[model samples]
Target chain A: MPVSIIRPIDIWFAEQIFPHEQRFHAAALRISGSRDEAEELVQEAFARLFELEGWAAIEDPRAYVVRMLRHIAIERLRRRRIVDFRQFADTDHLTLADDAPDQHRIAAGRERLRRASDLIAKLPERCRTVFVRRRIQGESSQEIARDLGISQSTYEKRLARAVELLSRSWQGDEDALPAAAGPANTSRRSGSR
Target chain B: MSIFNEKQRRKRRIAREAATWLARHDSGTIDEERFHAWRGATPEHAIAFARALAVWREAQSKADADTYHLLQSRFTRRRAAAAIGGMGMAGLLTAGAFTSRAYAWDSSHSGVGECKRLILPDGSRAMLNTDSEMQWRFSDDERSLWIVRGEVGLELVRGIPARIHGLDRMASLSHGRFNVRLEGAAMDVTVLSGKASAAPVSAPVVMPGQPALIPIVIASPSEGLLLSAVAPSVRKASPQHLAATIAWQQGEIVFDNEPLQTAVREYNRYLAGKIVIADPDLTGIPVGGRFTSTDPADFLSALELGLGVRATPSNGGYVLTR
Candidate 1:
């Protein structure tokens, strides 16, 4: 087929594949649902097939993309960075976690997250990314692993390590929550005890 | 530093080390046992690793701003530097060196960075640099070029017929971005908009945008249809032009007030000539004008005149004596 005809088909296939990209992250999240890892798996899937020459040349580009992403994510789990935004149920909402209906407060919190993000940005290239996908974005271990070409097991351990040191590294810049400190209530109890 | 500051510094130091070790381990330098031993050294070690991971994640969030910004910046820097040093055009001009094609046509074209030029069935000449792949599409009305991978220079003459689809009409087509349909080999790039559209092997008209593979015919064009065809193989952007593709044709690289250091990248493209800007402050100096690609002297002169900097030829390439 001439290239002209292939493009529209690609656009169409891209939409279909997007869901699969989402599902894969959810699957990876089952093991370690860190936002970073989930997105890593999602991104790796997309990158693996982003430049695929012909959508029809392969029988199932989606499956191929998924499998390739899974394999790559598994490989990257040992490393850091697989590749996209891992979508949780409410990712598009852009609201804060608070029960209050105050948009201004939510916006303020987002600003704080941004500041916290700036701190995380100081990390080295790959690991900093793993930190983002695993911590900031709440991606699962498998997804971050998939994105970074590492294993899921390593993703969990590494992410736990990231969560352990947020207070000192970030110092007083508070907005984003530290890696995985349970809940505010749990923290208060621990602090009091 | 205060006591809190000192304590915080010690903690961060421990965390940063642990993070570096984990990153290294991920790189497969250290084994799991070693990783665990380090982990057990102190609770601070674990915290440090976690902190480092936080830093690492922040870098990624920034990347979400643009997936290829870091990579593109490097390419841009190199391209700019090459243009500034005037070596890309210079080497190509003096050597008239054709960045060649590895068409599996000849043995010599198959090297790491070989240059090969191919005479299209149309009179246009295509020069492929090392590690580049291009396919010539010879159809009746539209003579198309599929630069499947890497970069190639296309020179168009008057008679070559490369039918162009305008950027406005692009909503209907999906061939490529930056399609330049020129007349023959050196007709000058005029159209670089829209995408490449043509049939694939068969029945894949709906699948474009993604890199495409089709069971295309291998034979050179049949003789009879040659005369009736008028194709403009390359399509360049018309309104606001991009310089990358056509820079190969002009022996003079034109930078419109680009950073002096950035322009040196254009020079590095053709020759092993490297330009080091010793003064980091001078790195941001704006540069403009057309310099002959063959010599760094002209480029150095531009820097001296434009930015009052002295250029020193290094052991390998050229360096701006900071």
Candidate 2:
């Protein structure tokens, strides 16, 4: 809890562990089922790690931090006792829980979500279908291929195409234009004053 | 394929392979040793694998209810089959064309203190006032525009049969210039040139100055159409009111003996920090000016000097009291 006391060693430790931060957060999200909880759990774990004596001597720090965060998440989950496994099973994935603070991060996340949605909207119809089936509907590759009357390899290719387009969009490539440049900027640029 | 296309295809193939490996890894089906070996095979492989993993994780985590609805609406099973049965490449080309055209005609928005002018595909022009958003749809047979929020001035072609939809009513124009303003559920249509027939989407046109409930509909493909019923009264726009209504387009706020409350609201639309009237009695004080829309400080000075009101800074904005 003494995390407010900043020190050079803490800064060094945070920098050392920065690369693994996302992976640790992803693992924590898997266990916590909430992005805010996962972020808090990871920050708590980092603070705890910094408080430990001889922190410099720890090997495989990424694994150590991940393990600590997972333990914290599991303990919190047990304490809450409100974990309904049925909610996880439901594919609706409603993000009703408010995650306040870090407005910049929330804005960036929303922008990413908007961009991804726009890219998905522009996908070739067949490719989009395969992607939705595999990712959103949680359908298996073999089942989708059989249902679509396409070879398994072809289905996989379509899925890959969808992924490729999404990746390009996230990377802000020309093929998948950014949402800000979508209708407004394009028209402004092409139309005469 | 050209060399550039060939190179892109090769990169996509690698990315796809990496994506497949990451998917398997996430599902607990991949051989860890082989996966590690494949990732370490080359620096490019590791980079692709990392990017693919990030994309997959983000896709999984961010697919909330809104995204689910969008995907479901667009990628239904029957439509998927039809798209595949038709020429796949042609379907993709047409989809791309539609998307670009929609972009060109979809929406125009202006930030605070900023005015935007847009030239429609048919050579007509529209100027949007500050803090406004409008959606437009243009086709070979008809030209339709919806002022979803804020104010817009249109200079239509001679005979385009254009229709402008506002909050509580829709105006049909055959060849004229006009402006539409929507505040909350109230719509005010000003005819600058020629003429337009106004009617509620769900009801017949009512006499001017009579209160009537009118339903407004905004057409959207994914969500169908959004309909809102609002009680609004229409007015035959006079020259005096029309100029004041669109003064912001000329970078000024022309308040002609309006209430302080109305002038403050109009000023807030074009400025960043808002002006708050702390006393209820101050709302009825008459205000008239031709100040620049971007300068609220000048307005405050005028209020303090001419109206015998005191202006004090409060909560990141100025509060006025008499």
| Cα error, candidate 2, residue B31 (Å) | 97
Candidate 1 lDDT tens digits, A105-129: 2233234446556555544455456
Local distance difference test values of all predictions, in order: 0.43, 0.59
lDDT of 1 at B285: 57
Query: Per model, how much of the real contact set is kept?
Result: 0.02, 0.15
Residue A139's lDDT in candidate 2: 76
Candidate 2 structure quality by residue, lDDT tens digits, B1-322:
3755775566567666776665454334557788777766765565555455445544543453334334332223223334344433432332232232345458889998889999987888999988889888888887988787888888888756787776434567656666766654334555555565544454645567876555433221111121123222333332224446656766767664456887888788887778888999999665655567887776787776666788898876789898
| Candidate 1 segments exceeding 4 Å error | A1-193, B1-117, B129-150, B155-245
Question: Which CAPRI category fits model 1?
Answer: incorrect
Each prediction's TM-score versus the true structure: 0.29, 0.37
Cα error of candidate 2 at position A136, Å:
70
Compared with the true structure, the alpha-carbon lDDT of candidate 1 equals: 0.43
